[model samples]
Target chain A: MNQRDPLKRVLYIDLSRKSFWIDDRVDLFERWLGGIGVAVQLFKEEAPKNIEPLSPENPVIFSIGPLTSLYPLASKTVALFKSPLTGNLGESHAGGRSAIAIRLAGYGAIIIKGASQLPLYLVIKEGEVEFRDGSALWGISNANTVGRILREAAIGRGIRTIMRIGKAGEKLVSYAAVITETYRHFGRLGLGAVLGSKKVKGIIIYGKHSIPIQDKKKYREIYDRLYRLAVGSDAMKRYHDLGTAINILPLNYIGALPTRNLNSSRFEGAEEICGENIAEKKLARRVACAHCPIACIHIASIREPYPDEPYFYKTTFISYDHELLYSLGSMLGVKKIDDVLRLIDTVEAMGLDAISTGVCLAWATEAYKRGIITINETLVELDWGNIDNYIQVIKYIVEQPNDFYGMLARGTREASKHYGGQEFALNFGGNEMPGYHTGYGAIIGYSIGSRHSHLDCAGYRVDQTIKEPPSPEEFVELLIKEEEWRQILNSLTICLFARSIYNVENIIEALKPLGYNYTEEELKKTGEEIYFEKQKLKLKLGFKPEELKIPSRVFETPTPHGLLKREYIEEALQHYIKLIEYKTLQ
Target chain B: MYVSSHEVKRLAILDAERCVGCQLCMFACSRRFGDGGLAKSAILVRSVGGIERGLTVIVCRACLDPPCARVCPTDALKLRKHGGVFLDQTKCIGCRNCVEACDIGAVFWDYETNKPIICVHCGYCSQFCHYKVLGVEKTI
Candidate 1:
């Protein structure tokens, strides 16, 4: 074990006792190599089998890699928990001050368990942990306001991370996000709701511990090489230019946009609300994570006038990314860019996962139009592209004013279960599907993924670009291979944006200077092991890989590639099921 | 007390208007000392309140009188020829007098070694500030 790094400290906090303890888990660090690797292992150890996700027994783990502060683009923190949305293994990664702050704070991972009796906001500076009373902050109107309060109260202003939940999390909106640094988040799988259930409102991590290096010259050489690759690479520039929102126009152009309940693949108003127009018209600023040179976090400034005052206006900052655009802008049939920004802003303030929230509202609107859901149930006339009504409905979802909102707050899958819209529920596995409806890979990836997330496999990238459609067996193989490799990325917890630059050759080289000497084959084997561990967690929970569902809407609508035959999806999913099932025995 | 302001090179925050708050300059500062991480950083960047407003870069202002030097009981915070001060670790008693002395919060403390970390005016951090929020200048 390369115990050269003293930063491999695991901090455990028990909310029921309101006590914290630190342990040196260098063994886990050496095996898993940190980030998702360490987080999933901690989660499996602490989270009891067959325990409900929202219960006190569930564990929330945050882990960053040993290569985190030592390298550029190693700027993501892996968050693992049991999913309240999918009722299975939950994994989410976030970048900002989060990864660097946690790594510098002298910890490889943090495992928090047990529910608190009272509302609590954890304050962690360097090593000391203080459980601050968050009674005043609970049920705050906006998530931003909670961040503003913690930003001032916490020490180490320049180099710190503040992760807080908003009204949605407070109400336990099933897909509520644990927002970090205002813009970034552990955005999927209801990590925030798990925290809310524990009566924990927010967490602040501050640290500035010096890292010791064995070989200084080698460290500089690797750092310079990676940094140059990041800045010089055209792939990275795409993120800097338009961020992930760059995908909107291209995906729309390809007729795979998933517009308006995915009844149509192409969005007619894509030109008006696409990345180019937004970057040209409304881009307020671009920000980066601590070590990342690529400033992909794009903010838009939208000015709206007061109702009464002729000239009085309020300028609001709304963060935009590919997922938010697809979910709110196209999926909801929003035409105006400002309207999309407004919806994005509403979800951000409410602390909801914009993707799931948008999909839920889309289904609700379709269900209402089809007479499945009545006006009394919705409390409003839910319509397509109706921004004003959508705003009110989002508020209702967060507030959970009635039985309908409460059911919808659980997620699209749960909502569609009670109502008669399972066909158009548009959920892959139990989690609501992301923007892509491209091909077999995208469909199977979402349904079969451990996290039920697009980031897990990124099969959409393959589905959209490949010249020939991959066969059902080939498609399942693509997902399996990609998921395994992604385990490596998530473990290193490098930003997905820099995946191309940090190839296997570079990853093996990068690990050397950080005192983690490993061969390429060994790294591949590690990824394989990490993938099975996540699969084990999923199988241990209620998720059956064979029981994965193919939502009817995906087949009903034709993507740019063509109408996806039910046989193709079923065959591909079967192949994946067999693959995972065989792994359990070994 | 005679205020000594000598002619020498120093790093200064030029304009924070365009700062994106990457904190790469701080990484560069720590790297200059043959290590990684912000424990030994001489410069710092933070949001004014929320990140939407941009960032404020806090480095050695190269103070005219140098309050950090005046409060140093063991002369650890040596008054440099420039506006800032140089920290001599051997002389530092780790009492943290200089950390409290700087009203601008330029003095960063290293809890590991129990000493105040001051800027050496090497200008390494300024080179990495892509936004040019920081610059190296001659202060007489």
Candidate 2:
């Protein structure tokens, strides 16, 4: 890393003390690169082991990378903290103006430590940090309203990012998310709860600093080439065209949709709520993260009439993608596109992780059907595809009106512990299951994954290619290889959608003009090191591979590769454990 | 070296609706001067209130009679045949008269140099705009 590069700066804010300081972390940046690599290192250094994830001791570290703002598609910001949801390593990536804002703000990472006694929001500008009273904004129900208020209240309109939590965060729902730029989020695991626990309502980052390049001509040449590839490539066309929601119909057809708590793998009404239908009917606009040419963020315009006024109507724009379409639509058996959008809107408003919320609701609805839970506990009928009841339940989850809703707020794993629905509760590593039932790869991948996210390593994609499942050793190797490479991509903080464009060669080429000269071999080694560092943290934080639960519902429901065998997943998981242990020992 | 006003080409927002708010044009503009980052970029694309509302591309509109040039007390900002102002760095007193004068907020400042960074109507940024939101048009 260049000594003069602002990316070498780390901003440490002690919320409890109301103090801020800048540390030149060239050693950390040069060694780990940036984003997840640097973030894991920061988390390990700052966060103590086995501490309560919601405690003020848990540090929330947000880090970007060298490629941010300088290159297209290097637009994601990685947030790392101890997850209140999983009680393990919590890591989430979000794209918007976050990476650009933080980078331009002249910091590679921001470590927010300690807890505030009173509610507050942080305004981080070019060289200053302001701790503002967030008492008025604290209990604001709608996340969008908070954004609106802050947008008006704060400066830096064009080059800024506003990351806030809603009622879910305020109430400390385990799956609560930190919404950034309204549409994007640090949306998985319990980053919001961590922020909520700290009494930090929101954070606004704005900066306008120029990055000096080592070789301007080389930088432009590489940039133009990448830009051409990004725009001209067919790999990114699907994302720009209909976005990830395009996976809905295809996944549904292959019987991997995981509908109604995995009671069935396929949704009959998948066509109605698929990407094509939504794009045709409701797609109001497409937006992009800063520096990304592929505007994959699809916002749907939902216009509805007010019940009180027959003539008056209001239009709402809600962002939707495949995960949302699956988790809120198919998982809940929501056939109507509007209902799915409405459910998504409700989830966003409350600032809950849509996947966890949907999966939790699916479990609750099943438990209700089985007479395990009743209307007395639910206060409303938990029915599949019932948007109104789901909406009410979503609110209750955040509000925690009862013991049942409180358990639901913790996520399905905890909800089922008392409710007698353990077998069907779709959670892996205590985090709610992502929308994939492809095969063993998906199950075992989630089981052993650092964050237990499908994005950790796309096991679902492996399921798509195989005629016969690979040996446990082979499968683990495949997963580990992809995941290791992904560490490099995540460190660059490039949008995973542009994975094809930023291959190893391109990544090396891209970093060259930025002053970091890395060989392919060194890059690969860095990836492995980053992955192992995260694994070590997860282990220290008390993640056990042998104890990972493979929901019985995954086996019961037929996947694209037919019914997945429990034995195969266990073998694969064991192989993964052995491999990771061997690597960690080294 | 004065060119005919009719032959002068200026960067234009061909279709503002096509902008996805990627701000690649902004980066491209900054990169044209041999650096990376938004500090040097004269073009600014921002959401119209919130992103859900859509985006507004703010750049030099190349007004027929530019307000930015007219307000330059130091005569640092010279009107180009293309209609946009050309900043003479040596002459710029760093007064920021042009920055406040532009109603559309097109004149951007380079804090490091303490001078105004204005677009010279170079089509470099337009080449990188995939959505066709930006282009170079002859003032004629």
Candidate 3:
């Protein structure tokens, strides 16, 4: 890394004392690269052992990479903390102005520690920081409204990013998400609740600093090559056309959609809410994160008339992808696309993780139907495709008026323990299942993944491609290989959708003009090191890979690969544990 | 009167609705200086309100009698043959009068040099705009 690089600077803020300072962390960036790599090291250094995730002692770290702002598609920011949802390693990546904002602000990473005594928001500009009073903005029901208010109040119009939470976060719902740029989010594992716990309302960051390059001619050459590949090739066409929602029809066609709490794999009404339908009838426009040419973000327009005045209509734009369609649509058996969009809009407004919220509601619906929970526990009836009742229950989950709602707010893992529907809870390693019910690989991937996310290894991809399922050892090996490689991409903080375009060769070439000289082997080794560091931290935080419980509903439903046996998944889990432990020892 | 031989070319916003707010053009504008960043770019793109409303592309409209040149107190801003203005950095006193005069907010600031960065109408940025939202036209 260059000594003159602003990426070497680390900004530290302490809310308890209302102070901030900078340190030249060249050593940390030199060893770990950046993004998740730097974030994991910082988390280990700043966080105390056995600290509660909501406590001020839990550090919130945001980090970007050297390749950011210099190259196309390398525009994601990695946020690391101890999760309020899983009580373990919390890592989420978001693409928007977040990475560019932080980088141009002239820092490789920002670390926030301690809690404020009152509601507060921080405005960070180039070489300056302001701690503003957020007393009036506190308890705002809609997250979008918070963004709107702060947009008017803050500076840095286009180049800035505003990250804020909603009522779910304010109430400490374990699955609450931190909304960024109105569309993207740190959308998993309760980073929002952690922010809420610290009494921090929001953060706005922007800058006008310029980044230097080693060789001007080489930089232009590589930049042109990447830009041409991104724009000219078909590799990113699907994302640009329909976004991730394009996966819905195909996944449903293959019987891996996870409809209605995994009672069935395929949804009968999937055609109504799939990507093609939404793009045809509902898509309002497409947008992109800063520096990304793909423009994969799809926003849908939903117009409805006022109840009293038939002629008066209001149109609302809601962002949607495959995960939302599956979770809020097929997972809950809601067939109408408008109804699904409304559910997505509701979850977005309340600042909830759409996947976890839908999974929780799905479990409750099954529990209600089975006579395990009555209407007394749920103020409204829980039924499949009941949009109005589901919306009411979503509100109750945040308000938590009753004990049942309180338990539900904690997550399905806790809610099922008390409510007696553990088999249908559909959570892996305490985090709710994503849209995939592909086979053994998806289940095993969730259980052993560092963040319990499908993106960690994308094992579902393996299930989708393979004709014959591999043995448990082979399956674990394949996942480990992919997961290790992904650490490098994430360290650069590139959007995973551009993985095909940013192969190891291209990544090595791209770093040259930025002054990072590294061989392919050295980069691979760095990736492995970052992965192990996260695993070590997870172990320190009391993660037990062997103890991960698999909900029986996954086994009951037939996947595209046929029925998944519990013993086979358990075997894969053991193999994963052994491999990881063996690597840790070395 | 003798005119400069340089072609009177200026970047134009062809279709604001087609812009996805990628800001690739802005980056391309900065890259002409042999670096990668948004600091020196003379073009700006932002969402109208939220991204849902659509985007507005801000650039030099290449006016026949540019207001920026008229408001330049230092006489640093010179009018191009047909339209637009170019900055004479040596004479500029950094008054920022030209920045305030441009109602469209096309005159971006170079914070490092503490000078106003005006578009040269190279059309380099238009080449990178895949959506055809931007184009370059030669004016007489």
Among residues 3 or more apart in sequence or in different chains, the pairs in candidate 1 whose N, CA or C atoms overlap within 3 Å are B62-B83
Tens-digit lDDT track for model 1 on A1-586?
3365756799999999988999999889889988888887888788656888899998899998877887888889998888888888888889989988888888888888999989999988656889999999997899999999998887878788999999888888899999999999988989989999999999999888778887788888887788878888999999999999998988888888999999988999889888999999999998989888788899999999999989999999889988898899899999899999999999999999999999998999999999999999999898999999999999999888889999999988889888879999988877888988787778888887778888788888888778777788888887878889988998998998899999999998888767878898999999989999888877888787776777788998887678889998888878888888889778
- Lowest lDDT sum, 10 consecutive residues, model 3 chain A, at A207-216
Q: RMSD of model 3, in Å? A: 1.9
Tell me the deviation in Å of residue B129 in model 2.
Answer: 0.7
**CAPRI tier for the interface of model 3:** medium
Interface RMSD for each predicted structure = 0.9, 0.6, 0.9
TM-score of each: 0.96, 0.98, 0.99
Point out where model 2 deviates above 4 Å.
B1-7
| Cα lDDT of model 2 by residue, A68-161, tens digit | 9999999999999999999999999999999999999999999999999999999998779999999999899899999999998888897999
Each candidate: chain B TM-score: 0.89, 0.92, 0.94
CAPRI docking class of candidate 2: high
- Global lDDT of each candidate: 0.86, 0.91, 0.91
Please report how far candidate 2 places residue A85 from its true position, in Å. 0.4
lDDT by residue (A479-545, candidate 3, tens digit) is 8788989999999998999999999999999998878899999999999899998998999898988
Return the candidate ranking by DockQ, descending: 2, 3, 1
* Candidate 2 docking DockQ: 0.87
Q: Give the TM-score comparing model 1 with the true structure, all chains together.
A: 0.96
Interface RMSD of 1: 0.9
**lDDT order of candidates, top first:** 2, 3, 1
